[model samples]
Target: MATPGVFLISAFVFAFAAANIGGALSYTRPPPRQTLSVPLADDLDSNSPQQVHVSLVGEDKMRISWITEDRAPAIVEYGTSPGVYGSSAMGNTSSYKFITYKSGKIHDVVIGPLNPNTVYYYRCSLDSSRAFSFKTPPAQLPIKFAITADLGQSGWTNSTLQHIAASNYDVLLLPGDLSYADLLQPQWDSFGRLLEPLASQRPWMVTQGNHEIEKIPVIHPHAFTSYNARWHMPFEESVSDSNLYYSFDVASVHVVMLGSYTDFDPQSAQYAWLQADLGKVNRSRTPWLVVLIHAPWYNSNTAHQGEAESDNMRKLHGRVDL
Candidate 1:
């Protein structure tokens, strides 16, 4: 016969031994945790025009956006004197912003009055040889430009962009759906790094696309938080900075950027604001009026099949006659 206290102690010792054995076995073989990396890549090759593009941000002003393959300081050398570009030159150093967990820096350089239609030589680089140039289009001239969406593509998609680029144009406007973000962090980083060329040379203006919508997985939150966060668009005060929606004067044209993802319905603040904005366009000063929205209301593409909300807003602004 054993004392109750002694028996209790013996039982406790046995349990402790069993627990230690279990712990040892578990330590020897345990499940692994999956780790992820924020994606960023070597920018486009140093000074090479990876995604060279241009946009007329305003009268006498051309915005150029491009990419480099490396993380280096930016150097844009330009001048009205063609052969004397590097000499008697107007030099402006620029910067590239790499978003959190994303790769590559977004670079912008604005040049102006460009002799209207004269051939102006220019070059852009950072940390090295970003040599490039182009002739600015003449002012008050009817210009042809390419428009597309779902860019920031890889090699295959890049081929498509190249196809579009083959056509000469005064400006390039990308409405949205740039990266085709599929919840992979590295893909996002690579996308930014790759587009440096086009973004740098051209204005490469854009709106938040469907891919810009944030999500935890393939499901559907369809939120624009990620897009809004990464971009430094003027959506508040300076024309188009506060919310990716604003008005700007481009030569004789009045351009309006609308925020379809946000509230643009009659009851929303954006709707009222836009009505007020369009009301004041002063058609006399700006002859041609244009509207840019991520999701166009009337498109044959099934992806935009039922964009009823955007359709409604577009109808409200029928002045464009769509």
Candidate 2:
């Protein structure tokens, strides 16, 4: 009973819709890419420094961190020229145990009052003949920062590291999920050695992710055991007692690294610290404020949707002026 023109238009629309539905039903997801694990360096001597990396401390200080099989002095000798040591700073050493795995001696030394935008040559300890060097970030604006997240130990990580190394960035800001050790302590060492080439040359400021929570209930009874022992941030300077959350200033920017896996309720310490930290920020001096968190506050992806961390953080951000 329909008119010929109307019938023809309806048929066309039906066919088009059917074709699109069929295509959608037949769509196949591509296979995931294969990623290889980065092996640990076996060439270095037992006492030789390995996994050497640097991180920013206060305004004019750098924290040199490294691991050695045998106990070594937590000392760093640095100067402008190679092999010409002028000043030295000593720090502390500590290690951790994870189930059956025990970590090597980890040394952390805070060397400082360094000149900005200048390269400084340094060595870990007096016993080592090998030397390494790093360039301090620029003191003022136009400072370049490389932001990375969820960097696991894999072939993809290597490729990413190579790209970051070529970027010549002044500082590196890692949101979280470093190493992806996931309770495997040795993977942390492998990750350190893997990133040392780039991390040593520049400052890598990082925070904790879900993967860093290596707590195993009563068996382990502790969270971030390995992380706390290794990647020590300048939380004390920010008046934060825990290393999980902290803030630092570089150039004209102030960066706040928040811990998404930790407690962030209204009555939590992290929440209180965040409120105080933001209150103390002087926007006049620091024109730019950058905040980093592992769990995204806004994500369209179906995965990790409606997670408590993301939900609470999003709500919290709405309350804050930032």
Candidate 3:
């Protein structure tokens, strides 16, 4: 006969083992979906703007970003009504080279001390036929944000975009894993063209993910070389030295986007900036504080378990309320 304490210990061990076996048996993953590549418009002229998207600049400004195959002026003309030009803004253009791939001229123009909640028609370069319009976010509360993540170019991505478009959300928050180009540079252009339809009309704020880090050991040693050149976030406006992380405000909400792929150690610039950014936030003005990070601090999924980024970031939870 076993002692009472020994019997209890034996029973506890049995139960724990049974639970682990049960969990493992129940876990199942669905089949992978087919990948789809969205092609560029066949009718677009060489100088015509393609992959046009917009992002919020400061409080009253919007940054219009697009790509052109040939040399095109980085100019944007805009007004409240369609086909009417009341204001114009000039901006800069740049391109990047990845391995043997050379990108088209990328243009970014910041427009307006725009009115909140009002629609503004805009044309890129000198083309009136390619006119696009976007509504600025409201000045007050009750704002809706359509949050999404891991938006690789696929058939599923198309469905997701359609669902988001019908939702009528004010802004879109993407925590990372965009494009999934993974060093195939042309895929980035394809992804941009796919996103232009929705991203053009609304502000899409995003952070960097592991997929964005297309670093090769000898040939291409740099990380985020492609991503930094393409998705230009308002990092400078927030006084952030790197484009990997930044903060922005929409209505009564304050959003901070953190980079999981970047250095997040306590001694790193990202960690230091996060402390200062959170400290500067006025809780009275922006009632809600939302932080976006690529890797989750706590996750039940088996794929990305026990990551250093997640562990290190979780440690800061006690130091900061976030």
Candidate 4:
């Protein structure tokens, strides 16, 4: 025989406790696995294609790049649908030489005249392993892109990938310092595999960073040998002599990716090209001009304090805009 007020209070307390417990049980959890459908290291050690990625070559053309344990022809069979690849294209492959290890075969093929803003499916091999799909950028305004730099292999990198995948961005612009492969070559392969799920699904346009300049002493002191071998950009199409710098346009946005590690003085080739590229930009077509470089011209970081690229660029009519 409890009082009416006591009975009501007791019921209310019970309901509150039950609701909190239910809420706790319903909390969302991240997946136990690292990345979706990521193959084991053993699978990547052979001729199997690893670190497969895509890049936009033109309005109607796309390039697919991958690495293999051995030299193989760059073959890509693509069409508007999966398993129905009525078209096939073959390209070339190249390898990079290090002091100890010779890198696997790097393959690249530019396939073209694809339907705008449509989801296209393709297989990399003549004996295709897994079919991948990518959507061409729409020929209209409001293009969405995700840009980041210095993405070394770590747990944070894993989380970043998961977030990027969920966002469904149209393009990925990595200014520089990708993989942090530095001297250790195996990390490059690992980085590629980790990025496959996201990069394979979108265009990952990149430029060289200081880290990419892995200059080995004694045997091979040359720079960018490994970086140049792995990442093949469409600089040639843009009439640029070096892949170290290039520009591309998507919708109303024109992106200029510069090489901080390369020459940027007034008399340098890059500076001259930059001037010509800027002069040719039609504001009517591309209203927004965006520039990306690994080292910020106006950065306050003490690590790169001695660098005066920002000041030098300004003197040469290269203004930094946020």
Top-TM-score candidate index:
3
- The local distance difference test score of model 3 is 0.83
The order by descending lDDT is: 3, 2, 4, 1
Model 2 lDDT, residue 185, Cα: 81
> On residues 116-214, what C-alpha lDDT tens digit does candidate 3 reach at each position?
888999999877669898989998787888888889988889989999999998889888889999999999999999999899999998888889999
Better model by lDDT: candidate 1 vs candidate 2: 2
Residue 143 alpha-carbon offset, candidate 4, angstroms: 0.9
Alpha-carbon RMSD of each model: 22.7, 13.2, 11.3, 16.3
Per-residue lDDT of candidate 4, residues 135-191 (tens digit): 888777667787777777777688777888888788888888888777888778778
RMSD of 2: 13.2
Q: Which ten residues in a row have the lowest lDDT in candidate 1?
A: 6-15
Candidate 2: residue 55 Cα off by (Å): 0.6
- In model 4, the Cα lDDT at residue 195 comes to 92
Give Cα-based local distance difference scores for all models: 0.52, 0.81, 0.83, 0.76
Sliding window of 10 residues with minimal summed lDDT for model 3? 6-15
For candidate 1, report its TM-score.
Answer: 0.60
Q: Which consecutive 10 residues in model 4 have the weakest lDDT in total?
A: 6-15
